[model samples]
Target: MIKLYIKQAFYQLRENRLISLVSIIGTALAICMIMVIVLVLEVRITDCVPEVNR
Candidate 1:
């Protein structure tokens, strides 16, 4: 089940501290980069004011 997977993950993290730290930091950075890219695209594609002509 999901609980078993989580328990195993914690055990691995505790067993390998350096690898766990690197992987956790890498995952966080990747997530932040993706979010920034999506937000930038959203701002560029949306219009704040009305356009009179096409």
Candidate 2:
């Protein structure tokens, strides 16, 4: 079953290389943007705390 699934995946990849590339690029960009936003929010939250309380 796994072998059959792999074969089908390869066939589709060969048949639609451009579509596959675009999908990968779009997913990567989305993940990168999400990480950047999360990191910025984390830094801002941490920086807002006053150091004298600690």
Candidate 3:
């Protein structure tokens, strides 16, 4: 099942500390990149109304 596959993946990640660290860092970077893109889009498309801005 999916649980078994996830458990095996975790076991392998733990067995290789360097790979695990890189994986963690890469995931974090990806999340940060997504957030940055969202912020940029919001800034670019936001309404410029006085009430909304205030």
Candidate 4:
């Protein structure tokens, strides 16, 4: 069940604190990097034209 899987993950994270911290930070950094890239692409495509607004 999902509960068991979550409990197992919690225990694993608790047992290896350093590894868990590193893994969590890495995942967060990767997600943030992806979001920044997506935002940059959106801005570049939407706001790059000068004559569109004026």
Model number with the top lDDT:
1
Top-down lDDT ranking: 1, 4, 3, 2
Whole-model lDDT, candidate 3?
Answer: 0.93
lDDT of each: 0.96, 0.92, 0.93, 0.94
What RMSD does each model have against the real structure? 2.2, 2.3, 3.2, 2.3
Which one wins on TM-score? 4
Tens digits of per-residue lDDT for model 3, 1-53: 99999999989888998998998999999999999999999988988676984
**Which residue ranges in model 2 land beyond 4 Å of their true spot?**
1-3, 48-51
Query: Residue 39, candidate 4: how far off, in angstroms?
Result: 0.4
User: Could you tell me which residue pairs clash in candidate 4?
Assistant: none
lDDT of 1: 0.96
Preferred candidate (TM-score higher): 2 or 3: 2
Candidate 4 per-residue lDDT over residues 1-54, each given as its tens digit: 999999999999999999999999999999999999999999888866679866
Q: Which has the higher lDDT value, candidate number 1 or candidate number 2?
A: 1
Worst 10 residues of 1 by lDDT: 45-54
Candidate 3, which ten residues in sequence have the lowest lDDT sum?
45-54
Query: What is the RMSD of candidate 3?
Result: 3.2
**Residues 1-54, model 2: lDDT tens digits:** 999999998998899999988988999999999999999999987867579577
Report how far residue 28 has shifted in candidate 3, in Å: 1.2
